[model samples]
Target: MRRVFMIGGAITKFGKHTERNLKSLAAEAISGALADADVAKEALQGVWVGNAAQGVLTGQESVRGQVVLRALGIGGIPVVNVENACASSATALYGAGALVALGEMDVALVVGMEKMYLDDRTRVLSAFSGCMDVEALPELTRNFANQQERVKKGMQRGGAKKKKSRERSIFMDFYASLALEHMEKYKSTQRQLAVIASKNHYHSTMNPLAQYQNSLTIEEVLEAPEVVWPFTTPMCSPIGDGAAAMVICSDEYARRIGARHSVEVAACMIASGEDRSKITESTLSRLAKKAYERAGVGPEDIDLAELHDATAFGELYSTEELGFCPLGEGGVFAEAGHSTLGGKLPINVSGGLESQGHPIGATGVRQLVELYWHLTGRAGRRQVQGAKVGLAQNNGGSIEGAEGALSVTILKA
Candidate 1:
């Protein structure tokens, strides 16, 4: 495949845009990206749009790409719609990159947009449930019974104050189970999870596009309202509305257009989750291994990253799976400050999903936008100095006991 270059990208502020629709958000991001790339809509050879739950949330079903882009006077191109749960936009990016790499198109636009902040919160939450296997939900949730009891006992022993559980995303329970398992097996503490949350909150203060800019102390995070045993409200990502867009082109196109700040897509790989009982490398680990090998780099060579921290535990677990730290020692790694700014390798400098906001479809593309800024020395305050190599890990949905779909993208300056 030919080399792909990301010439430009942009993201809207991530927050509860209750008044906005998908088209408004997409237009803003797409306009910003086009301006950044110094290209016009006419230059886009094809368009790929990533959105999940749009049909369920807003009743906008198929032809999402054509519907959104057409309103902006962009039409008559091959518009592909992608829905891969949370990895929708990343999958869209992968598609655009592939076509560009294969000489099918020189320039392509990838847009990820989601409008999830609605008055009917139940409907919003239910959209998340749709990402999983509905047929097996009965059996899957039944399995939660035993794990819930085990988690409760463990939390009680750890002296965790019980907070009444409210209606929240089912993913929280999954993360809670993972946290409990990690704690039981590795002796990691809930306080370590709080530390990760606190760090991301602090990092969000530097990200103007982040949904929550207020930094929470570790103590504050620990004392906040609990979503699950070890996860406080601040430790989980909020439902939000946002959009992110990117302008990808072939290396030749970049040179021909005099693109001065293009970031090379060294490697991008997508993998589906396997049976948890297999006991081999997890989905993310296997994907990351392929990405690193294809990029001719290792975890240590990465300067910064934007991980899918749907929950603080998600970040902790990902740090281990991506080989950023030794297996089962993610808590220890964060406690040592290795994953914070100016440390060995900063992770989630954009505040991650916890603070930066996970707009589902937008998150995958938003990650690359953050990394592109840092790679080009444009990240205002949270910039990792001298950042050259960056990685982004985004996963969506859930299978038997793993992420339904996972993607890893490596970028180099």
Candidate 2:
């Protein structure tokens, strides 16, 4: 297989955009990406678009890519639509890179865009519920509620003010259960989770495209209104709308075109959660190992990272699973300030899903856009100095015992 490199990437401001449609948001990001790459629309050999909630929220089912691209006068090429819960765009990037690596195309574009904000909040949330097996949701709902109750009983503490129930996403409950289990088994504290959240909030203050850029303190995060027993409002990702796009090309194509600011696609590995009871290693751990091997690098070689912090717990959990820290020490890892800026290994420098906003399909690609900026020395205030290698971990949906889809992508300057 040939090598691939990302020439350019861009993202729209991530927040509530009820006035905008999918086509408009996509056009802005795609146009910016193409401009950044110094390539015209006609240069794209194929296109991959990722979205998750348009079908449920706006009745836009199939052919989402064609509809959005045609509006920009980009057509007459292979167009693929991808949806893998929150990993939609990351999965799309993997596909585009594979095609380039196999010589199927020289230049390709991958876009992840979503329109999630609606007047009816239930409709927006039902879209999230659709990520899982719809048929099993009946039983899953019961199990999820039971797990929440169990975690609450296990906590045996109270006094957090209750927040609006309508604002809670189903995934919040999932993360809460996982966080509580970690707390119970490893003796981690909610304060550690708050530290993660507070740090990301501060990071977003420097990210103009982030949804909520205001900083919060650990004490403030702890005192915020509770979504679930252990989770406060700021600990969870807010529903938002945005788009992100990337322009990738084969190394031969880049050299032929005299591409100057390209970053190597060292590795992009995507996988699904297997039966954990039968498997010895978890999905993310297995993927991270394969990615490091493919990139000829180890975890210590990473200069910075952008993890899928759907909730603060998601960041903490990923920190350990990705080998950034030892098992059961993610909470301690954050408490020690190892994951913050200018630390051992800065993480979620884009503010992550929690503070940057989680637009489902767009989030995975958005992480890459942030990494691309940092790797190319375009990230302004949040940039990691001399960042040569960056890693992104994005997971989506929920399965019997793990995430429905997970990906680990490593990039090098």
Candidate 3:
């Protein structure tokens, strides 16, 4: 396989776009990326578009990629549409990278976009339910109830009262349950979770494209309204609309085109959660090991990361799963400033999904865009000092006890 390099990357400001449609947002990101790469539109050999809920939310289904690209006067090329919940765009990047690595295409364009801001807030929020197995929701709910009961018992025994949130999403509940388990098993504290949230909030202040630019202190994050126990509203990712795109090409093509400052794709691994009784290894852990091996680097070699922080717990949980720290020590790691800027490994310097806004399909690509800037020394205030290697983990959809899809990408300067 040929070596693949990310020649360019771009992202739209992540927030509610009342007037922009999916195609328009995608066009802006694509144009920016093409310009950044100094590549002409005609040079793109293939296109991959990642979008999760356009059909359910906007009534646009098959041929979504073709329709979107046609508006930009690009056609007759293979336009692949990818949908894997939040990891949609990252999956697209993996697909495009594969094509370049296989020499099937010297240059490819990958774009992830989503228009989630609708007038009907109910409809907009309800769409998240699609990420789960609707048919098995009843059983899932039963399991969740059991878990909640256990949590309540644990909290009571620990001389604490369980708190609940009015916001509805099985995902929040799932994360809360996981947080409770972490707290129980590892003695992690909610205050430590607050530290993570506050760190990301401050990081977003340096990211112009982030949805939330305001900084928050640890006290403020802890005082924020609860979305779920151990998770304040500030700790959770908000609904938003955005688009991100990247231009990837084979090393030969990049060198031929004189593309400077391109980041090499050291590794890109995609995997699904496995089914097993008393599973010992998590999907993220398994994939991270494969990614590290493929990249010829260890977690300690990574200078920065963009994790799938749908919530504060997501970052903490992923830190351990990605081998950045010992299992159950994620909270301690965060509290010790290990995950902060200027620390050992700065994760989510773009503010992460929690502060940058989670635009579903666009999130995965957005993470890559942030890392691209960091590796290239473009990240201004949030830049990690001398970042030479970066990793991104994007997971999407949830089923019983597992993520439906996950992608891990490692890049080197």
Candidate 4:
């Protein structure tokens, strides 16, 4: 198999873009990526577009890739539409890399875009409900109710108030439940979660394209309105609209074009969550192990990471699962400053989803764009010193006990 290299990557400022449509957002990112790669639109051999909720959100269902690419004056290419929930764009990158590695395509364009901010906030929240199995939503709701009851009981016992809000998605409840479990099993504190959120917010201040670019203290994060117990509004990723794109090509094409500062795709591993009844390895752990084996690197070798921190707990849990630290020590790891810039292994120097803004389908691709900038010494203020190996973990959708789709991509400078 030929090696795959990312020649260019670009992302729009991730925030609530009420003026942009799907095609316009995609075109902006695609144009930026093409310019960055120094590759003309005519040189692209294939196109992969990642989007999750355009059909429900915008009523544009089929031929999304075709429509978007055609609007950019690119046509007759193998346009593939990918929808893997939040990992949509990352999975598109994985597929594009595979095509290039197999020598089927010399150059491929991967774009992930989503327009999530609609006039109706409830409609926006309802769109996320599609990430789960719709048929099983009743059961899931029951489970959520039970979890809420448990949380209420725990709060009552501790003399804490039960904050209420119907504004957020069910994912927060899921995250809160997972956090409670972590707290119960490992004695992790809400303060630690706040620390992680605050760190990401601080990182965002250095990121011009981040949705929330204000620095947040740990106290502010903890004092913010509670979305779920232990999770302040600052701990969660906001609903946003954005797009990210990248140009990936084979090794020969990279050298032929004299691609400057091209980052090598060491490994792109995609996996599905399994039905595991025990507290053993998670899908992310299994995928990360495979990625390390394929890339001939380990967590110790990874200098930085862009993780799917849709919530602060997501980062904490992923740090442990990715072998950055020992199991159940993610909170401790964050509290010790190991995951911050200039720390041992800086994770989410791009502010992560918590502050960078998670645009569902675009988020995974955005993570890679951040890693590409970091690996190529392009991340200005939030750059990690001496970052050589970078990892991106993007997971999408929720099943009974795991993510429906997960992608782990490792890159080298």
Best by lDDT: 1
List TM-scores for all candidates, in order.
Answer: 0.98, 0.97, 0.96, 0.97
Alpha carbon lDDT at 228, candidate 2: 81
The parts of candidate 1 lying over 4 Å away from their true place are 157-161
Name the 10 consecutive residues with the lowest summed lDDT in model 3. 156-165
Q: What is the lDDT of residue 36 in candidate 3?
A: 91
Residue lDDT tens for model 3, 1-413: 99999999899999999988888998999999999999999988999999999888989999888988999999878899999998999899888899889889999999999999887877776778788888987888787778877765666434344354455667887788788878889999899999999999988999899999999999888777767676888899988999999999999999999996699999989987676345888878989999999999999899999999999999999999999999999989999998888888998889999989999999998999899988999888898879999999999888775788999999999
Comparing 2 with 3 on lDDT, the higher-scoring candidate is 2
For each candidate, what is the lDDT?
A: 0.92, 0.91, 0.89, 0.91
**Weakest 10 consecutive residues of candidate 4 by summed lDDT:** 156-165
TM match of model 1 to true structure? 0.98
lDDT of 1 at 135: 87
Model 2 residue 116 distance off true place after TM-score fit, in angstroms: 0.4
The runs of at least 3 residues in candidate 4 whose Cα sits more than 4 Å from the true structure, single-residue gaps closed, are 156-166
| Model 4 per-residue lDDT at 171 | 85
Model 2 Cα displacement at 355 (Å)? 0.8
Residue 296, candidate 1: Cα error in Å is 1.3
Model 2 C-alpha lDDT per residue in residues 98-176, reported as the tens digit of each score: 9999999999999999999999989988998888778888887788789877765665565643554456777887788
- As a whole number from 0 to 100, the lDDT of residue 82 in candidate 2 is 98
